[model samples]
Target: MRGPHNIIRLIRTGATLERTGAMKVILDAYEAPRLLRMVVRGVVWPFQWLGMKGDTSMPPATRALTALGPAYIKFGQVLSTRPDVVGDELAVQLRVLQDKLPPFPIDVAKDSVRDALDVQVRDVFDEFSEPVAAASIAQVHKARLKETGEEVAVKVLRPGIEKAFQRDVDAFYFAADVIEFLSPASRRLRPRDVIAHFEGVVKGELDLRLESASASEFAANTVGDEGFRLPDVKWAYSGRRVMTMGWAEGVPLGDNDALDAAGHDRTRLGERVLQLFLSHALRDGFFHADMHQGNLKVAANGDIIAYDFGIMGYIDEYTRRVYAEILFGFIQRDYKRVAEVHFEAGYVPADRDVDEFARALRAVGEPIFGMDASHISMGRLLSYLFEVTERFGMETRTELILLQRTMVVVEGVARSLSPQLNIWDVAHPIVEDYIKTSIGPRAVLRDLAKTAAVMARFGPRLPGLVEAALIRQSEIEAPHNRGGHRKMWALMFLGGLVAGSGAVALAVVL
Candidate 1:
């Protein structure tokens, strides 16, 4: 429950957003009853007279969220990936939620870095400079290390941004509550869960150390991976509020003229973009979730350098296998198995007819089959697949949704590099290779070796398990036992039975 002080802050935040035309933006995007919109409008009506002139309508949904603040900007970003909840048009609009915040004062940033890392910025860094870029969450400054003189990028958290986020997220939570109350049917969309996920994302991103750790983890995951690389994290200078990383220098993927002027191979880079993204998602369980053009760069050597590790996504091995099978089924043009995988994975409800789902999936995959590399559009195929998912009543999978949206953005970025590049052509080979290597006959032997290694480690514990069982048996015979020998014997017998059964089961699984 919110205290009075927090409630007051919520009201003020709501009024400010309303005054800024954010309320109207939501009202327009979300089609609720006219009466509801009007009623809500009536509540904020008094604010228009409070020294604010006419022409109060703000920018579109994307720009409005940007205007609202950092937290709302993140909300817009999340909604961009959630086409099922926000509808296609609004989700498309929300993709423009880029960070264009004005930089904080250099003194403030210096103080923040000093306080966060518990040292003078000058002591650790030489020629520390003003921020080159400012986002809603943080800003980055270019600097060189005092010890090694290695150029590094220093990112400092926005001062008091956490409190601002808390207040705004409180308002978001309140709105979510009202949404569920007013429209019970929307509960299936999991509005509260979505907000909770949004809240978690923003909160997690606030801690710079998490981002640094993600960068290191991602770097480790893609050590030998081709065409994709992560900037090295400077652990000594990074902390909860301040992060330092190896300076990344490359033409951003968005810079068409620069890319063309660099004389890079467009066809290869585009295919690499698609292939790298798929490999990241399917091969490495982790992916750089925010892979927009701004966060990616094309190095001089033609490798892709990714920045902004704050928003990473992970797909566990089980989901990876299911995903691979689904892709394999689609690649093979076996829509029935694709549908069956969904049912087998319980993604589609059992009551749903498998044949109907197959036909639906066919509708998504068939059109792109015979198209040449230049003609096929991966984005359109994914859009169709999303449509099929909605029609089949599949609930949202957050990880997969992020993957889907990232793929769209990546494919878009790839298209910018090579207008005629076929994404599926690049994706198909990568997915096929992964399926063959990780999910085919080779995987069986790999699993057996892994199982053998696991058993080798656990074999030492078997004696300990038998010793513990014997201890229990001895306890059963103790004359002064609390439970009495009869009860103890039953427990001992049951424990022994379970242990023996488990050993047999482990043997069979191995």
Candidate 2:
């Protein structure tokens, strides 16, 4: 039999606490019982005292976050967006938790590629060089195409990373459970659900096929955009553990001198990037979800070639319309309309006063809208929105928060390259276009056609539906269909027996 999950959770929390020492400090130095504080102090005080001798330049908080490993670092990235969670200053500090690791051995990388594709290394490529970039999940290397005499990049997964992540995730869930059980107030954040979401996304990232699919989908979505593009996947050399794609040619966006020297138009490039991202989000309802500078490249033809599509986002047409309305409302200074839209979307509680929420949103919008691009701050808007949401018992939407985080990062890059770039200016046209296209007469006709097709497909089921309704009406109105009741009861009994037997068989096989 499986052991109690709660027991595993306690061990994970204790281990995390011992390694990080934040919990000990929180309990001992901040609040709680004297006895418990003393116990924690006695346990963690030695580590604080004797762990480092000299020249430990990194701050205690930094060291603690690092000690927690990739899971914590990723958490730090998420927390950096939540000014409500860790406060602004702490969030800023946590944003620097870089995800860098030494490259795995070349032999290991080759072995992984061979095993995943069931082919020899020499047969796969003309030449493969050492790693050019290394990250938590995988590393990339420059390679030559065998048939076309072209250059490409080979991305290989880190060996045995899934096991390591699974172990840490097990520890994370355990801690989240104990926190929720011990503190009734902690459940509001849904810590366990947050951990589960992180697990799903990260585990998905470990699969190269999923990432390739994301890249292909994004490329298809934005193919019409003049200056936007995604790397073309090399299907012949891609699988679950390996990805090969066209090697983009451009200096990193971080290098100002190279960008200037290449005669690149920084302002135009910035505008195109902002517009492209908004189009992907608003027009298509599918986006890159991660658009940091490292994942973007400026082509010689001025196309922004996006890479590393491990994370993608999707929303239905209704949600996209609501999102566009929110943006358009904000642009028009129609806070009341914005509040009404949120209520209509079931984002805020129905009982909450729309006028009051609008006033709060106004407090966030008016000051920022008046400022220039350099002075405006999305982070402040987020803070106000979170505070407003908390008052109405609004829970977090993981996808929304991730979208916000990416927007902040993308806007930062735009401003760095072109300081006068206004995100609102770039987004307004795209949002307006989406609103016009989706809410006009054409959309109505299209939706009507779709409904007609669905009705035709279900036309045969109408008789069954009518007969079932009549039988229900007869039973309810008369209350004496003994023959029908007997037959129904007998059929239900047989169905239960069959279901139970199948379940038992499945259990045995598993």
Highest lDDT model number = 1
Model 2 agreement with the true structure over 1-510: per-residue lDDT tens digits: 123654443344344555554554434322345655555456555555333221135334444555555555566555665544455566556666566667999889889889988998888789989999987788998989778878898899988887767766777777677556665565666778768777878878889999888888888888898977677899889999899898988767656677889888999888877778778887888988768788888877767888988777777788788878887898888999988988998999898988989898898789889998876655356556767777776777666666666677778778889888877777778888888888787666566555555545654565466556556756665546776666656655655554454445444434
Off by over 4 Å in 2: 1-43, 46-62, 78-88, 476-510
Worst 10 residues of 2 by lDDT: 49-58
Deviating ranges (above 4 Å) for candidate 1: 1-25, 49-59, 370-375, 453-510
Per-residue CA lDDT of model 1 for 64-130, tens digit only, reads: 5665568877788888888767777778877876677889999999999899888998898887888
The C-alpha lDDT values of all candidates are 0.79, 0.72
Pairs that clash in candidate 2:
9-174
Using all chains and alpha carbons, the TM-scores for the candidates as numbered come to: 0.86, 0.84
The per-residue C-alpha lDDT of model 2 at residue 284 equals 88
